[model samples]
Target: MIRKVFSDTGALAKAIDGFVPRQPQTDMAIAVDAAIRDQGQLVVEAGTGTGKTYAYLAPVLLSGKKAIISTGSKNLQEQLYHRDLPLMKSALGYTGTTALLKGRVNYLCPERLERQISECHRPDSEPGQLSQLVKIREWSSYTESGDLSECDALAEDSPLIPVVTSTNDNCLGKDCPSYEDCYVVKARRRAMDADVVVVNHHLFLADVAIKETGFGELIPEADVMVFDEAHQLPDIASQYFGQSLSSRQLQDVAKDIHIAYRTELRDTRQLEKVADRLSQAAMDMRLVMGEPGYRGNWRELQTSPSVEKELVRLSDALDLAHDVVKLSLGRSQLLDAAFDRITLFKARLARLKDTSITGYSYWYECTRHHFSLNITPLSVADRFREQMAEQGGAWIFTSATLAVEGDFAHFNHRLGIDAKQQMTLESPFDYPNQARLCVPRHVPETNSFRRANKLAALLGPVIERNQGRCFFLCTSHQMVRELSALFREQLSLPVLMQGEMPKQRLLAEYLSLGNALLVATGAFWEGIDVRGQALSCVIIDKLPFASPDDPLLKARIEDCKLQGGDPFAQVQIPEAVITLKQGVGRLIRDQQDFGALVICDNRLVTRAYGATFLRSLPAIPRTRDLHHIDDFLSGSDTDSNTMQSHLLDQPIEG
Candidate 1:
């Protein structure tokens, strides 16, 4: 290991010098540098204030190895590529090229845009659509990035994405007229040649799921694969392996059918009939699934024989549309457009039939007025293992909560990594001095889920004491709504609920409000930062446990049970530990951040397995007395040692 003080003038040393290390961050950086330099795998759990980004980046940039950093969200991806990576490169004096690669749908296709504009100008089109189409034409001329994100008129969930972009399933490949000028292909090519590629877990898993060559395809094999926010990989993998066909795909087919065969029907009457049938089929499916609502697991809602019959009828109409286009293949642009749409629709329908249920689960979902059938694989360990073996690179999976009480068995097993090589580095943050963990002394565990009134009654005093800069993180929307209503009635603070506004906007409002209390679901538990005095308390309503009845969870637990493992111990416990850590982490985001973490779930104090959860947290001063929390928040000079002693006196449940 290269040992040097914080002031060494070398590139990596200078970057380290600028970074203020709170013991944990410096130790983690040294460990990561050692692991990378020695060509080995290491898992480090650096706490919230540890500045893990610089710890990992220092070694990654200095090692001069082609690295692929996968983050949990697009927001994080942009943050790294645009902000962190550039800053680190400048600080370290490294001149390596890097590229940010997003999914294909984000980019624009000139061919599809031209076709849409051409169709809009036809005499039969509605005036409103023609006007919108004209705007797209003007924007398409000078847009160099070809990214739809730059277009304000386009909504992220718009059906226009599929119409104007390409997917692996429907991409015309080299056969298309715009193949040479494809934006997606261009971005991907850039990723292949770059020294470091930044991507989200979704795109990374998509590559793993679809590309089987194991080498020399889209992403070049790298020397190391660093999963920055490694905790989200499993859930993201579940999404990619799942199957879903959207109503938008069907609707697009209907529009293309009209475009292709409209010329053949001189009477315009027959053209309207085909369009109406396709539209009706889509509407019926939407009605069945409830358009604009996110419904999971469509198996519960049975489709009658009539609905199935209509699908067949729609499929036949699509076939007829395809045949018409095939006949006019060499003749007109209109027929060609219809042919492409018909082909995409048929392919999507075929995928639904071929959807695998043995190792995965399927569901029908509707979001933003679009309906889709989704299928997700139960376990991705086997697939991830294959990638690891094929890539044969040094892999480092680190997170604030990868282990429960120093055990990496659960996370390692899920990701198919060897547990023997694992290492756990606790956050060097002075949690015991700077923070406190509070579990309300007595709360009934038996009726907790059902008795919302009682739960809210217990939460009232705690909220009152904190003076509203609290995040009431609940496990379900039902709890969030119930608590928000109760808190609003009892508390004097401005109470904001999750669904009141978009999450990012809501967080912004919450911070701006200064002393407002926010009731939110699991979305606010992690990947949220409320620095300074804005957030002073984090109240967890219950232990974060995966629903036992959830299909994905059930499948994973069953698989674990079959392998002679205790599903709760091996899976549920570790999963909850990581999640609870995320919730507790929200309170102390910065070194100056001092707050209280109150978990109202009595199970943490009464259950035999509770010690595992407690051990996973930082050595914080804990208390069961509501008065101590009141005194601490009130700026009273309470003895910190007394609080620590009180926590130690509590019986270790296990």
Candidate 2:
């Protein structure tokens, strides 16, 4: 029956305009159906070209089950809800409704937006700000859902955004003036009534956190949970389980108070003064911390006496802001929200200041425009397991990359999942025939110009031969900048760097310019799909490894050691393997796609641990010869397309 659902005349196939069925997709559909029927847990690693989305969605629609489809990327969420779901419902002729729901921060709080527009219209408001407000106000009128995505002109992190958007701590639920037409309420109601709800991991984890607290809920009644990109769930879950306070939050609070004080029923002068002080405190806190960079663990920062004194002043200013906002709480819901936010912010800061708390780690991070302090739990497996037990639903976890080396032990243990069944489905693409692996013999360190030039020599010919259809992925931003500069100085092709434009725009340019060498870092590593000749080669600077000095990485390492485990073999190596796999996965997106994956770091051929990274990749031909790589990219290597390689079947856990 599951196979029939994907047949040529089946509803899923008929609903889609140009649908083709594959054996792996049908197999996945069968597995999902069985998992749902048994009310058990499943860990499935499906390779690219498996049509995993439809494999899961077809069963979900056919079963008439109330399911929550959680994805890692918002772009994917929108794609599913807007395109995939509608096509399935229409083709299958299903009666169930589907809804797209994102985190609270994604939607515009109308009550807050109206107040902002009203203030922006005043004579004292800057012309530029008022102009932006008028444009937004115009958009809000016709935007049926009031989603921020409708206003493409406004950047997500714009100062104007905090003026209109509301967070979990500041939303005026049913007491707001726009209660009747609240977009969030309407969206939630749709999800509650629908058979399937689509949500990103952040919103899904938020709902879990909210339900655990016994608060008023938004998670609909669901019997099954379908997780796409499940590899990221465990890492993202840690964020929601922990607590953090950022300069952005404080800035938002101060901005809200300033806007609210203009019309509150109290003496506006004192409140305005207090609001300015609060904003100043937030700014001063970031200033005293450092000059636009991460200053890990507050303990390291406390040695600077001036930083300590500024922190004290920030605390005092918070106290004053909270007291003033409390006095104006009854004036309006906005003021009430400001008061609540101030109180919560102060409490979080207090907890962060307390060093006696066990089972947790604290750190401070600063950037050019913002700073943050986080109190993160050492581990969240127990809490995650508890939630899983409480939910008592059939959980289906699927991703392209999940296993370390044909084994799911690392993934299962990290998420505290006891899987009833598991499977690994390899991609149908002919890797040995379709692609080549090239690793130069001489590894170039970052600091050496001779090495950079040598590295450029190794890559420049490949790019020129391939007509500039390549991606240079690095582990660090500094590396990206450095490589981009070198490329601009040497090779002449339409060079596009990551931060030069928005991701979508950059991708568009890359697609349009058939021969373009795009230099990027982590953002382009995954979640990007460019098939055919547009992206024929991927060059990675080094193994994609998280910096050990990073606070989060340090905390995770300590957490594993406390449990009597090797952090490198258990944590660091596995992470790097998975990330390298993601970068390599970009090569074989379609059956017809062909590309070369190049790693300049000779570690893969020289170091003992390189075997682990090599095993995580598909069993493909490998070579240290650059001539074969050049011949392959030039499409002239006709002598037996497959090169022999000593491929390992397992990760070297030692």
Candidate 3:
């Protein structure tokens, strides 16, 4: 039945435009179907163009089982829920219900919206905030999902988001005045009743680790859990399993207390003073944390005189706020919530103060006006395994880049998965003929000063020749900024930087321009799907090795060393290989898609570890000559056949 669904004459072929039958998609569908039937564990790496989405969706819609499908990002979640699922439902004629659920922050809280609007009357409200709130109020009358993404007036990173939305920390839950009309509650209820609930990894991990009373019941109730982009599970799980306290969290509580005193409990004047002191303490703590964008060793920083003093003051402020709010707790629901938050803050501060614990990365990061103290466990394997056992259902993990050099050992070890079935299906694209892999002959050293300028000068012509249909992917944000500036100076086509605009808008601009270059880091490395001629070239600045200064990576390295293992070989190399493969996968997304992959770093040819990266990537024909790259992109390579034979027999070596 699954095979026929993915066949040339299948329902999918009729419903989905340009659907082609591929053996790998059929095999993956069969594997997923069996896993669902037996309630077993399975891991499969379905390469790009393998139709993995339809492969899994076909069985899921047919099975009549309650399933939770989690993707890597909310963008993908929206796409799956809004676009792919509808197509699949029509194709298979399945009648089961479906719902798209996200973290609370995505939904509009009627209580918050009302509170914020009432507060907007204050003379000191941020400029333009009122108008934005007014726009939201107008949209709220008819919006069904109450998803902020649907509100066209609001931007993704607007400061008003926190003002109008609720978090786990601030949500009043059953105590909220607007409980019946709460968008979050309504969304969760729909998810509970739906046969298929779509979510993202962050929400899935939150459910696993938090298990909060009312909001965390969705994942555990499902019979099957499918994690797409499963490569990102370990890092995400680490964050949820760990603990964190942010200055914004503190400031939020203080703001709530102030609002409560102003509107609900006018007699409690002490609440005003306490809230001001608490907010001041948080700002003072951030001030003492030194420059922004700094990730420091929390254990060391806590001992510094200034930080120590601020910590004491912050604790005192919290205690004082708790005492003040305690007197008027019953008078205001908002004050009661604030009181609970103060107590939770006290507990979290006490826990963060303890640095003697081993097997955890005690670290802190400071932004321009905020700071966050965090402690992440060095290993989440055991915890993840325990959750899987407790949930006890068909657990399926799939991604295009899960295996390193045809081995899943690194991935399995990180997540502690002992799957009964594992498979790696290569992408169906004709990579060798359709793609060109080039490590230019005269690339700058990875560590050189002004390396960004050098790379821009070197690859600028190639990008120009391709008419700016390129993605300049870098390992660091600093590099992204530098390259964007340089490209804007050198190239004539549209140059879009990641932070200049919202991500979706940026991508839309790229597509509409038809000849634009996008320079980005981190988020753009994976989960970005741009097919056809819109994206034809991907230039990577360096091998994406995790910085040695990363606190989590540092902690894991120490643990590996203590266990008598080579941390560099065991941890770092495999990770870099996986990341490199993902970046390379950005090219050649379709059978007719042709592009050039240029790695600006020479280590790919000069270092021994480079072979691992080479082996893990798709079999794209390699070349070092700039002329060959230009010819490949222009369809004029006279030596195309010879170059393929030569490069396939023996790739360029140092």
Best by lDDT: 3
Going through the candidates in the order shown, the clash numbers are 5, 1, 0
By lDDT, is 1 or 2 better?
Answer: 2
Give lDDT tens digits, candidate 2, residues 225-334: 99999989888887778888898888888877877777664466677888889889889888888766564876567658887887788899899998877866687777
Off by over 4 Å in 2: 7-20, 122-124, 152-159, 211-220, 291-295, 445-454, 640-642, 645-654
Candidate 1 lDDT, tens digit per residue, 1-654? 223423344454565444443456667777777777666777877777667887788788888888888888877888888888997888777788898888877888777677677777788766676666566667777886677877877765565667777555445566677877877777878878888888888888887776621213645568877888798877887776565667777676566556545544444455456666766777676765554645555444435565466567667766665665575575545445556766767776666655444666656666666687766776778877877777776788888878888877777777777622566666656686677788876654735446567767876787777778889898888788988998889888899999878787798899888878899987888889788778887888789998665656776777788889898988888899999998888988877777888887777777778888988888888887767777777768356887866683377432
TM for candidate 3 is 0.97
Best by TM-score: 3
Ranking by lDDT: 3, 2, 1
Off by over 4 Å in 3: 645-654
Window of ten residues with lowest summed lDDT in model 1:
1-10
Comparing candidate 1 with candidate 3, which one achieves the higher lDDT? Answer: 3
Better of 2 and 3 by TM-score: 3
Prediction 2 global C-alpha lDDT: 0.80
How does each model score on lDDT? 0.73, 0.80, 0.89
Q: For every candidate structure, what is the RMSD over all alpha carbons to the true structure, in angstroms?
A: 4.1, 2.9, 1.6
lDDT, model 2, position 386: 86
